[model samples]
Structure formats: structure tokens, C-alpha cells
Target: MTTLGLIGSGHIGSQLARAAVAHGYDVLVSNSRGPDSLSELILELGERATAGTTADAATADLVAVAIPLKDVQNIPADLLGGKIVIDTSNYYPRRDGTIAPLDAGEMTVSEFVQAHFADARLVKAFNHIQAPAITDDAQSAGTAERRALIVAGDDDDAKKIVSGFIDAIGFDVLDIGPLSASWRIEAGTPAFGPRRDREELEIDIAQATRSARH
Candidate 1:
């Protein structure tokens, strides 16, 4: 069984934990607040899940970074090293202050995070999906049908690993090239959390993908 670690047991982290357990993966979840704070969630996740400190959680086969963008440094580098990290964080200017690279269109959130955690195999995912939508319903619901999940990473093997996890959780995986191209799927973009059907998501990602500059 793949051991999944989660740094930051907030909305997305908790949801990912739940989904992972639902798919039979062992999950270790934690936040800045400590394991005691997540006792209830751990209990709810049953034997498949456990709560630990942020650093401990970062040591699993797959680690998820779901905390606020500004606190990325708080996650110990040693823990994130050599792990495939799923980045679901976004930069909220009001809370994270002004990030010049993001504002200048120079780097996406995952690009900055990857630079900070150089040893980790960083992949941008869960950032484009909504908390409620991802947590609720198996894939899609109502008239919407099911849409694809977009993932961007520099490592093909790492992306394939994350893509398998994504498919297990219910949605189709749409590979969106590398981390540098992640800006198109970031929060404010046309493809971000649009709740489009699978076909529509394909179209959105296609339109958003920029051509390589010569």
C-alpha cells in the first residue's frame, strides 16, 4: 500500500485524506496545530489513517502541501526531500502578501514552491479543483457529468504516480505539461475550478496551453 502524507490538515488536506482512505491508501495527516488537534479526523479515517506532526507527515511516499502559500517554508525540507509532493495551495494576496513573481507572471505557485523544496518531486494538482466539489460526489454530479483533474509536473514518472492517485479518487487525469506552464491552471485563469464536464475541461486546458517560445 502506498503511504500518503499530508502537511496541513485543513480543508483540502482533510478531503485528500478522506479520499485516499476511501481508495484503500494509508494516510498520515498533520497540520501546524499538532496531531491532537486532528484526533477526530483521524478517528473518522479509521485504521487507514493516522495523525502526526507536519514533519512526520512529510516523510511518506506521497506528500501533500495544503497550507497557505506564505507558510511553505514552515514545512521542513528534510521531510519533503525525495518525495512526490502534491501541491494544492494557492497564493491569496490579501493573506500571503504580494508575491512579485506571481504578479509579474514570471512564476506559478508550484514553480516557487518547487524552487524552495528542490529535492521534492513537485506536482501541481488539487489547486484547480474546488474544495466542495472535490470532497462531494464521486467525480461529477447533477447535469455536469464528470470533469477531468488537471496535473502539471516536471517529472513524468512522478506525474504518472499522481495521475493514478487522481484516477483512483474518481476523476480523469489531464496532464498539463510542466510546472512552468501551471499558470494557466492557477486560481484566476479561465480553466481554474470552472466545473466543466470532461470534454469542456479538455477544451479549456487546450486553449490555455501556451506554445513554446522559440
Candidate 2:
């Protein structure tokens, strides 16, 4: 069984947990506030879910970083090494403060995260969809109208791993090139909010314009 580890229990993280459990994946969720703070969420997630430290969650088969951009520094470097990490963060200057490389358009949000978690296999995914849509719109495999999620990553094998999990969780994936092209589906772009199928998503990704890295 695939155990999905979540490093943030906010809207996106928690919703991702629900979708993971819906697909019968065991989940270990953690937040900066500590495991004790996540007890209620764990109870809601039932036996398959456990409240773990960030390091604990990092050890799972796959880990997703869904916290606010500013919190990226808190991610456990040593524990996340060798794990496939999903980068679900958007860099908001107002909330996260401005990053020089990002502001200069020289690097992307995924690149910023890559610099921090260099040892981990990073895949940029699950950042484009709205939190509520993740659960409300999930469809079983082969469903006719499955939604699509945009994915960008550096490693081919790593992207394939996350792609399989995304399929299992009810969304078809659009591999929109590498991590550098992550800005295509980032927040505020055409591919960011609306639920779209693979074809429509492909169009959106192609028509995407540069927006705030947030």
C-alpha cells in the first residue's frame, strides 16, 4: 500500500489527506504546530492516519510539502533525502516575503524549493488545483470526466512515480515539462484554478503567461 506523507495540514494538505484516504492510502500528516495539534484531523481520518513529526512524515514512500512558502525552511533536510517530494507551494511575496531569484524571474518556485531540499527528488504538483476541488472532483480510474493536474519535475522516474499516485488519487496528470516550466501552472495563471481535462489543461498550460511567482 502506498503511504502518503503530508508535511502541512492546512487546506491543501488536509484535502490531499482526504483524497489519499479515499483512494485507500494510509496517511501520516504533520504541521509546524506539532502532532498534538493534528489529533482532531487524525481522528477524522480514522485508523489509517497518524499524526507524525515532519521528519516522521518524510520517511513515507512519498512526501508532499504543502505549507506556505515562508515555512519551507522548516522542512527536514536529512529525513527527506532520497524521498520523492511533491512541491505544492506557491510563493506569495506579500505573505511569504519576496525572494530575490524569484522576483528577478531568474528562478521559479520549484527551483527555490529544490535549493532547500536538494537531496530529495522534487516534483512540482498539486499546487494548481483549488483545495475543495481535490475531493469534490475526484473520479475513479477510467471515469469519463476525470480532472487533470499539472505536474513539472526534474527527474523522469520521479515524475512517473508521482504521476501514478496522482492517477490513483483521481486525477489525470499533464506533465508540463520540467521544474523550470513550473511557472506555467502556478497560481493566478489560466491553468491554476479551473477544473480541466487533459486536453483543456494542455491548452491552458500552453497559453499560460508569466504571472507573480506566487
Candidate 3:
């Protein structure tokens, strides 16, 4: 009965909640708007899901951050310290405003999130796929050509935990090295968006080139 905490209940967050509940994990869903706003979502998620404050969600066994990049600083860092956090954020200058480092190609979005969550075992995942794809594209284990999702983190154990969760929910996990190498699949890269299985994904990662930041 592991609890999966969600720090933002937007498209990605809500979709992940549905997937987690279907897989038997209790979910604590929260957003900047507060628990009351999530009542409709909670009822839709049925009994295993509870709407709570961001702080309460931060205390779950695993936490998923699906907020806009500009709002990352507002996440409860103190409570999330040492937690295995799955970061599913992508930087959009128009939406999140321009971030100097990211705009200059000096830091990956996940790295910026890591700096903020300093002590959290942060893993970059779910950022490359469409929000609906979170549940729609899941395939059982051993399904031939099963779609693969990429995960990057500095912690081996944390990556393993997140990878296991991804596998259970339907998809193969491809570790693309540490967070530093995560840029290989960021927004502009060939690895983002399109549905790719393990072999195809590896090729995309290899072909990834750092383009001038948008």
C-alpha cells in the first residue's frame, strides 16, 4: 500500500493519479489551488485517492512533481527532503517565462529542479510524453515493442524505484544516465513526444543534438 503523492494536479498530475490508483497505490493529490478544488478529481479517482495540501502530499512514499517550471520554487522543499521525487516538468519560455540558465543552454530543466529540491532524490520522467499518454499508452510487461519511457537521476536506487513503478503501470524504462544527461530528451530533442520503444528510443538519444535554446 505505498502512497504516491502528487504536487500538482494538472494534466500530468491527474493522469498519473489515475494510473497510480489503478495499480493499487494510494494517492494524495494536491495543487496550488488547495484540496477543495480537487474534490471532483478525488471522487472521480474513487476511494484510494485523497485530496490534501502540497505539504501532505510531500510526505507520501513517492512524490511526483508536475507543476510549471516557474512554480517549482514554491514546492515544499523542507518536507520533500530525501524523498524520491519524479519530476515531470518541461520548460516553456512563453508559459513559465524565460529562465536565464535554461535559455542559455547552461542547465537542463531537471537540473534546475534538482537545485531547488536539493536533498530530494529527483528523477526526470514523464516529461517527454503527452499527458493523456500516461495512461493511454501503457502496455503490459513483455508486450513486444512496448513503448519505453526515459528516466534520468543521480541515484541508482531511486531510479530503480521509479523504473519499477513505470513498469508496473505499463511501459519499459530506459535509464538515460544521470540528470546531467537528461537534456538528451528535453523538449527540442528527437526523443521527446513521439512514441518510441527501447531500441528506437536509444537511437533517438544517440542522435540528440543540443540546438540553440528557444
Q: Count of backbone clashes for each model?
A: 0, 1, 0
Off by over 4 Å in 2: 211-214
lDDT of 2 by residue, 111-137 (tens): 889989889899999888889998889
Give the candidate order by descending lDDT: 3, 2, 1
Q: State each model's C-alpha RMSD to the native.
A: 3.4, 1.4, 1.1
Indicate which candidate wins on lDDT.
Answer: 3
lDDT against the true structure, each candidate: 0.83, 0.88, 0.93
In model 1, which regions exceed 4 Å deviation? 140-145, 209-214
Of candidates 3 and 2, the better by lDDT: 3
TM-score of 3: 0.97
lDDT of each residue in 47-89, candidate 3, tens digit only? 9999999999998999999999999997666668999999998
- In candidate 2 the C-alpha lDDT for residue 136 amounts to 87
Residue 103 in candidate 2 has what lDDT?
A: 81
Using all chains and alpha carbons, the TM-scores for the candidates as numbered come to 0.91, 0.95, 0.97
The worst-scoring run of ten residues by lDDT in candidate 2 lies at 205-214
